[model samples]
Target: MESGGWTIKKRSNSSNDSLSREYVAETGCLSIVVLGASGDLAKKKTFPALFNLYRQRFLNPDEGHIFGYARTKISDDELRNRIRGNLVPGKGASGEQLEEVSKFLQLIRYVSGSYDSEEGFRLLDKEISKHEFSKNTKEGSSRRLFYLALPPSVYPSVCKMIRNCCMNKSDLGGWTRIVVEKPFGKDLDSSEQLSAQIGELFDEQQIYRIDHYLGKELVQNLLVLRFANRFFLPLWNRDNIDNVQIVFREDFGTEGRGGYFDEYGIIRDIIQNHLLQILCLIAMEKPISLTPEHIRDEKVKVLQSVLPIKDEEVFLGQYDGYTDDPTVPDNSNTPTFATMILRIHNERWEGVPFILKAGKALNSRKAEIRIQFKTVPGDIFKCQKQGRNEIVIRLQPSEAIYMKVTVKQPGLEMSTIQSELDLSYQQRYQGVTIPEAYERLILDTIRGDQQHFVRRDELKAAWEIFTPLLHRIDNGEVKPIPYRPGSRGPEEADQLLERAGYVLTHGYSWVPPTL
Candidate 1:
């Protein structure tokens, strides 16, 4: 098959026979339309990711053209210049790499339009069609990918415009797909309504619900770590695991995003989608195969097995001076921090507590999944004194997976100390540049892979688990406790963790090893 200028031929290798096949689009020119091109998300993530893909040759410069669509009236050059500062070159980048950035910027074209009107979309479609027809490709062989970087409020109308004015004209091998960003909705009913709005215009297969966390390197490795490892197979259940904690923390508060942050808070912004997706992967049973359907089927089952969150198991907090932001209301009950325990009523995790914790303006900045193992039934050396066995998967700020185990102290007199079996990505994979989450996900969308993107049923199940709790917070039935900005969330959160059977190792900290 021909993609842009590159040829992809299938090879029958024994090692690759079991690997999932890549879905290549039909022979044609490709057009990527960024709907909210004037927005911050477009400038910071969307364009940069596309630039990286172009640099890596995953996007063919000759055939792929990017169209930036928004209400802001800016020339193509102005749009390019707005995003140029963010297209940073990697360390030790050569002159050729800098030149490539310039070339990638040239592929972007800008169009001014309203999200709800057909006039802008018609002009946008005309631009895309002209590009598609300019290529020496066969009729009905063009691919169109629409990325909606706008807010959820505009999604329905924008989607209506796309369906009415921007759909692919040919019914041949060509296709049109739309990628929508989260938060999908504020609650369950709203999400369903939003889904119905889009579902009217496109099929489920054409809609890609993106959650950036699934593209994280460590989060992507969860399946292989669980199913491929012999040692973890038997120990990953209620029998040997004590508690699992998925945590997200940031040292800085909502700087200027108080208006937006005030609406979603920590739970809707982080826990409901990002952290919950990680939880599904951690607790889900292995799928029968690596197909997208099989994997998502298992994830839905995990979500369904989650028991309702109890009031006692939940803790919410707002950092000090949060309301001081001009955009946030003084009487806002929003939570900048939250720690909640989710229990799965399945055989593998029946009795184990899956702790989901996320907070802003905290003591540190990091995201990690900590799986603490049960202590040995009869401890001969009192290994539990050091710490319970733990497998810590750091998701950001230096990706690594380390196993904390009790090791004999390196001295004549035998004593136990906790040490790690570490696999730090930077140290282990020296020259490798891990792709950004947006970079990988954008490539997946282009390749027609729905493995990492959320399915509609999956989104529904996710909303189901958090809607009741969210409504209570909305009604002021549950209030947020106040805590100092630089401190770890409310003291009650740690107490909740302890109540959930998490054993904190007092005198030990595992630092990421340097070269």
Candidate 2:
């Protein structure tokens, strides 16, 4: 099957010039307001992404500007210089390209504002308006985007204040969208309440729920790999597919996020949002079209159709406290890790078990999806034959897709051995720079494509799948099995899968390095 939009091709000399000129020409009048200007995400992701987009001519000249909002009293030059240091280009970034990115950096400005005050928001509106004009020389209102990169505790207040004073007055005649970062809520009820409050100000369509995982090239390729391939469709059911395994593990511990980690734990922090979203992409029925609503609808259906997990089948783990540079509190119950088994009740995967695992501070760092197919029934063995077919979609450290199938061993020997058919960006594609998660997400918001963006119902459904486990974790009714920092999670994680006749191969290789 032909790859979707991900197949990178050499940009012809003319095409490269066209794209560069496009960047130069379209740097039109558009405005981006980052609510948490001094935060890490703003410094590392927001400015760099806008600069890259601008450098790529994704924005026209004089087309837009960026506003960084914080309580700090830094000058525009200070902000520009600070962001410039972080704007180092990805591989293959030419000096000319870096120069282009620096030019876009000039379009950025800063504003001082208290997140909760009307005066602060009013001042912000004034700043945006003043930048929108070229002293009566520029015409037409620019598109406006407000990105909330703040902690969840203050998301609601900041969003409410912005809507009331800043964004409410904008008449861009183009579009206005608000981007809300992750950890949607403490639980389902809270997420629902927060959603209601935000919905009061911005329409659901205008709210972009950010989950960086959806922005990965290969993660997006999941949809293409499934729907675009005619070969996999007929055998994608329980009868032919044995099980699905998703692993999202980090090599390092909470990195001083212990305070926040203590509140949400692993189940809510990763499983509820990141891992479940990945599961939906893998297990959901194909949508009629690639529109955001249709795709999310299918994902929600998969979540709703999943059979509830029984007490014995679910496994949870917590890492031993670490005295890292960012101190982790002693006696912290925050799980750095968790493993879960979900059985789908739908017709397609009636008996298949979807094993999900994710954690922080592990033995190694790795993320991927493994699809184990049913072995050929009543196979005639050439020798001591035990053939298994597996397809793995690796997401990080290295991005690639590999499939294992039995092949005849070369030589006169009629022996069969498992061999891999692999496709990895690093090995196959040259001079290609894959975009960061935020870059793709920001572009999607601008392109009006919600296909990769999460919607309200999808979030609600995801919370439903994990709400019981959340309560169990909170009440201490569910005892968390403990594991050391430099190892795969508690032995229980392995047993959870072992009891179901499966083993977690390569668990050692998947541990994060910080462990």
Q: Please name the candidate that would achieve the greatest TM-score relative to the true structure.
A: 1
TM-score (all chains, Cα) for each model: 0.97, 0.88
| Model 1 TM-score (2 dp) | 0.97
Candidate 2 accuracy as TM-score? 0.88
Query: Residue 476 of candidate 2: its Cα lDDT?
Result: 76
Summing lDDT over every window of 10 consecutive residues in candidate 2, give the lowest-scoring window.
Answer: 1-10
lDDT of 2 by residue, 111-208 (tens): 88788888888888887777666523133334578988888778788888877876634342445689999988888899898888888888888989
Name model 2 segments beyond 4 Å from true. Answer: 1-28, 89-98, 135-141, 168-172, 323-329, 382-387, 503-515
**Which stretches of model 1 miss by more than 4 angstroms?**
4-20, 90-94
lDDT of 1 at 10: 37
Worst lDDT 10-window in candidate 1? 4-13
**Candidate 1 collision pairs:** none
What tens digits encode model 1's per-residue C-alpha lDDT throughout 1-515? 45653223333556645664755536778889998998999999999988877776677777779999999999999998898888856677788877888898889999999888899999999998888878875667778899999999999999999999988877887788999999999999999999999999999999999999999889999998999889889999999999999999999999999999999999999999999999999999999999888999999999998888899999999999999999999999999999999999988898999999999999999999999998888899976766798999999998999999888889898888888899999899999999899988987777777889999999999999999999999999999999999998889999999899999986789888898
